[model samples]
Target chain A: MLLIALALLQTTPVAVAAAEEPIAPYAQSNANAGAKPFESDGMWRAFHGREGVDRIVDGLVERSLVDPRISDTFKGHDMVRLRRVLKEQFCHLLGGGCAYSGRTMKDSHKDMGLQTADMGALVENLQAEMNEEGVPFFAQNRLLAKLAPMKRDVVER
Target chain B: MRIFLIMLAALVASPAAASDWRGDGKLVLTDGITTVEGAAGGGIATWAVIAGNETERGVGATAHASHVALPDFDLEAYGGAVGLFDRVELSYTRQSFDTRGLGAALGLGRGFTFQQDVFGAKVKLFGDAVWDQDRVLPQVSIGVQHKRANRGAVIAAVGGADDQGTDYYVSATKLFLAQSLLVSGTVRLTEANQLGLLGHGGDKGDDHTAQFEGSAAVLLTRKLAVGGEFRTKPDRLSFAQEDDAYDVFAAWSVHRHVTLTAAYADLGDIATVKNQRGLFVQLQAGF
Candidate 1:
């Protein structure tokens, strides 16, 4: 069921982009949708081999930091909400998109004190998660820098 | 239960030799390269080399205890480090400098001694402080050390200050994993001259000077790392000329949960003193 949903998502942006135009060359038809999915897959392969992202996310969720309540937070919403958020965060950060409409950084951590100790704990948790996912250090660093600035806001002590 | 306990012991002491394992040495004092591991003096207490960033963010910690025995004197110290992140590190240490019979040689009463408590933190700014394959420049970091002199009179008599000031520094390190080599250098600016609080104000001029420090490490095999460092200090006190210090070290990983590093150190000057030779050791453990 998840695979079908992912496949549908994988094809949506391309189909939409194609539908907006008149019939073009069959060769151009595949190219017009852009090459982001392939590139994302390449990054996934470099750090975590086949199905790496799934393995990583699985380990991350098991760490208990993400909160099982997270699923409940968006449970009633359609799969589109989950996919859109992931695409915007991961895809845009990876250079594929220019827009991200998630909650403001401060809003995301409003209730949490997120002290120095907490941040340390989070970093350790993520390191373990990435290690389990086989993410390389350089690659992880690049991804982490995107969130580094938030340290100032997230950590109160 | 016996079998389970043995298995647990094996797991606890298992040697972890992976390039990425951060818990292979003393935890608290060693940051990626320039600060002490939050812990102190299980060995090599007289230098400015911090741990690599790779271990800073992981769960690894370093704990050590040291004893310096000489014909006329003996000393002891303890400390360790817990790496909060690859970017930030925190450390603490306490040292007891026993005068013993040596106090009489210096015209002081026997058992006259000094004690020091130090706390430190270092944060990496730019570049990878440990592994940077795409660039030749080593990783860069900045940190500060705050020391409190328990014996204010002992420290002040030698021209030291009552309140030990914070010492600031910036360091860069490069690890050539493919070649099994590591090199690091650091520059520090501080009011406390020498490792001692003894030199509060420079008798010569400005209170601060650029201290050049460097370290080199070579891996003889998968489980062994041999290294050394040289650092130059400024002459700030009229009473004594500060000399440089050097140390040679060898670290062996017996298992994933345990690694031990041993070093021979020479701290150039203490109260116009010469050639202080001692041994340094560190034990580290973590996931």
Candidate 2:
């Protein structure tokens, strides 16, 4: 009787494992499928309503225009269109109800001769802008963390 | 020495003219405290991070004073370092080792002192400890230190072959920003006895041997870090058994220009003194 009970216990876990394993992936896929698009969140609304992101984009453009290290990269570019595209890109990244229609990070920065120092300057400017916009440090870090993966695509030199 | 002074002058002069210096400005606690040998690292190890606030385009310098008091001995060191373009570091340090009880035991009278000057240079090989977060690579550097001891007569009497020698090392440092952790490892090829205070190459052997040093730290805040370090030493002198050194240290970056560090160090045996342990304190100021 003891042996039979032991055998049942061993088989029961296997049965339970089989039953539980499939549901996890299924639930994960369902969650991914049901994820809301970026435009519906309160955080996104707050960010866009205050024009916080626009201010940040404006700050970046202004700094880059004068920065000796990176000013030449923007000499021939269209400033007004670039500003709009940057706003759209930042808004999309921050979960605002917008989609980015501009070039991918790699394509946009390709052949730009961007060095690590240039990237560092851009980040420094963005951080200053975030501080000026009264964004909390944690929030600033969150945005940086999200954007950090783009370094591989953006840095060519 | 004249070149070092000129470099120091350059370091002190540059920050005054360039007020817009950027490029991370030395990540918090990533610039390890200056070591006794005048390298940027923990108590006894050399880390891969560059010495000062200098980034890719600017220059920075730091001056440090350190004191270590043991049961039978005491050590005092003063030094300064300059970093250029965050790529190369040049440092000069002078150390005074006071053999109190051990000197008397050796019949050399009490409070005998051994002094040495160390000139060091380090070059960054690759990677950035602070910003290369998305990857597993750590910052790596290679360094060399030329040491010349002052008490050549005493050193020669104690079985040392030379009063001067050089040590070479390679170091790697990594930081996990999310976890607030920093780690570093160094391998040195050295023949120094008592860090070249008692001089280099002894009766036991004269060939340089590889030694290991490592450090791990957890950041308590943006500017404070508490860590421990372990450094293995070569036992080249037959008269005394050299043992590994260890320290538990706390470093605080009080401001952009100053950092204070304190530690409890166990330097093992020095000149037949067993289990020599004591307090270590250092102050660093830089641009």
DockQ, every prediction: 0.03, 0.08
Alpha-carbon local distance difference test for all models? 0.51, 0.78
| Per-residue lDDT of candidate 1, residues B239-279 (tens digit) | 77777877887767666445566677776656655566776
Chain B only, TM-score of each candidate? 0.76, 0.95
Q: Kindly give the stretch of ten consecutive residues in candidate 2 chain B with the minimal lDDT sum.
A: B20-29
Candidate 2 at A152: error in angstroms?
Answer: 6.3
lDDT of 1 by residue, A1-157 (tens): 9799567545664555433323223331222222223245445455444245434434443453354323333333333333343344544454443355444445445566444334444544555766666676556555544444455566553
> After superposition on all CA atoms, what RMSD does each candidate show versus the true structure?
12.2, 14.7
- Candidate 1 chain A least-lDDT 10 residues: A27-36
Residue B104, model 2, lDDT = 85
Interface RMSD of 1: 9.3
| lDDT digits (tens) for residues B15-110 of candidate 2 | 675665543355555678899999988878899988877677667777899999999889999888888778999999999998876788878888
For model 2, the DockQ equals 0.08
